[model samples]
Target: MPAKRKLKLVITLIGLLVLGGGWLIVSAQNHPSSQPAQQTQAKSKPKYRTLTLDELHHDPTLTYCSIIYYTVKHGKIQRWQEVSKVSLGWQIEQYPTNDGFKVLVWPDMNIKKEAKQLQPNWFALTKNDSVTYHSFIIHSFRDDMTATTNLKTIVDQINHDHAAMKVRQMTPKMLIVKHKNSAN
Candidate 1:
């Protein structure tokens, strides 16, 4: 039994040495510092931005947050597709929410598509006095954003566009737009 054990240990050591030698050869051939051989060989990347939905909120002059709820038509409620709502947690990331999900936040609500609760008129907001934000029509934007903006950019843009919007806001659904300052 001891002889058999010794023979097995020897075989294992030999196997390990062979593997190590093979790895060293391969490592030399494929050096860690090797750069791309040609510019054409480089892979093109997917389209996306470094900014996350959270960073959009920190804009001091923020407008409002837009939460996009994705619906998958998969049968059997099989996660009905992956819903992406930027709720305030418990991001199992599946949706059809009732657990109270909050995806977007903004100082102003600018949406392209028509929404039921949205009101186009500017809020004469007062604390303790119900300034009911009945949803607003979400305007369409590029594919990059669910809506036109996350929140801060919307507010900043709104601040920039407020003057023009005042004239337009004479009627409902007319967005509050501010014209660019001449100095700028």
Candidate 2:
């Protein structure tokens, strides 16, 4: 009888220990205590803008733009995409104010010949290139309110400042659209 009682006590103790071990393992798996994560940990993040590639095409004033904003990334731009629509020289973007374009032309004097000769050259560049009527990528909070305004404004401002066209020759008040590169 005493041996049987002793055996039962030992088994109960072992079972309890096994159960406790199992619970600890499960708890550890569910929530690791060693590696803690804070809700307010600081992280470096990149700023992004909503932009459309189309803005460059429609604007009447801009003869050309270089380095327009492509698709935005969640974090800091690690690398530039191959600038699918246009070359690296120019790109389109929307400013919050959309007040106007801030053109940083090299030798600011180029603005004169740039407007006259640049268009024809750029147009020739797109001679047989664009697959679409205009390859535009629009990004906006609402589909209606687009950042397209900025590109046009910037180009217009440049035009107003330079009063030049990429196309060399033109008729009176003729609306000219310069294709920066050949449109396939």
Candidate 3:
């Protein structure tokens, strides 16, 4: 073979090798299988963390007072309990008063009247005038069990903390009747 032709062939082979190597690097960078495991796992994690009662209260979106009921036991409430620093996503707001916690649950697309009925029960065990009832339909239960359980836990904590707390129980049936009658 001629020396000039041999040189041309060698140069072409070198150029092809360089182009193939560049293509492989670019393809590996774009493929997820070639990425580090940590990066892929991080992306799969949730963006929003579960908020606790304290965190939920400070949230800017919770504004409406959806429920307004007070427990009418024989004794007066001493003081309300403070929330912890833990993070959770129990989308509800609570305003503690001398009578009881005025719970304001967050808005939801699947809100039901039955869930609203569950609110007053958290304050009082039975049906009676002690558990007052006044709520609108703006906000409903995000997680009914979570909302009720948290409310009960907070109220219980507050009552437990106060030495002179007078907790009461009312009849659920009577309270429902009163609530319906008053709605007129």
Candidate 4:
């Protein structure tokens, strides 16, 4: 009888230990410790980067610009289409108001002559290709705007210009609607 009693006590103790071990495992999974959770969140974070307007304007490598032109009423429906892209020069200056750009352009002699004939006001002091010439298009925006937003405003002004025909005779204003540098 005593042996039987000892055996029952040992069995009950083993059963209790097994249940306690299982409960500990489940509790650990359901309620993770605060330190590890916070550590994991801290280890994984996000970063954002953007270019400033000044930096973008001064970039020499950004020498090319796509252009598009449109007329309000050429005695009929307004004819609009993309035109030849132009290459810019190293000289770039900010307007006195700090709201626009004066970029130097070295157009091919033929194009330059044609442009000179089209809009004499666009010509700077230099008429020949040896020196820098500024045929600037004005752009203005809030100081806090991003570079992309500034570019969008420039494009909008180019497209919406009522005197585009008078300025360049539909030689495509100084902005683009859709143009990809890639051939593909």
Q: In order, what lDDT does every prediction score?
A: 0.31, 0.31, 0.35, 0.31
Instruction: For residues 126-169, write the lDDT of model 4, one tens digit per residue.
Output: 11111122222225332211112133343344445533223333
**TM-score-superior candidate, 1 or 4:** 4
On lDDT, the leading prediction is: 3
- 18-95 per-residue lDDT for model 3 (tens digits): 999999999999999999998898899834332233532442221111111122222132111111111211234345
Candidate closer to the true structure by lDDT (higher is better), 2 or 3: 3
- Residue clash pairs of candidate 4: none
Candidate 1 vs candidate 2: the lDDT winner is 2
Reference-based TM-score of each model: 0.18, 0.25, 0.34, 0.27
lDDT of 3: 0.35
Candidate 2 lDDT over residue span 1-184, tens digit each: 6999999999999999999999988888777454345522323333322223354455422323312221111112222232222212332222111233222212122134444322111111121212111121234233221122223443334344442232112112222223333233
Over the stretch 69-155, how does candidate 1's per-residue lDDT look in tens digits?
111111122221222222221111111122222222222234334332432222211222121121233464322111222233333
* Clashes per candidate (backbone, < 3 Å): 28, 28, 13, 0
**Alpha-carbon runs more than 4 Å astray in model 4:** 42-135, 139-184
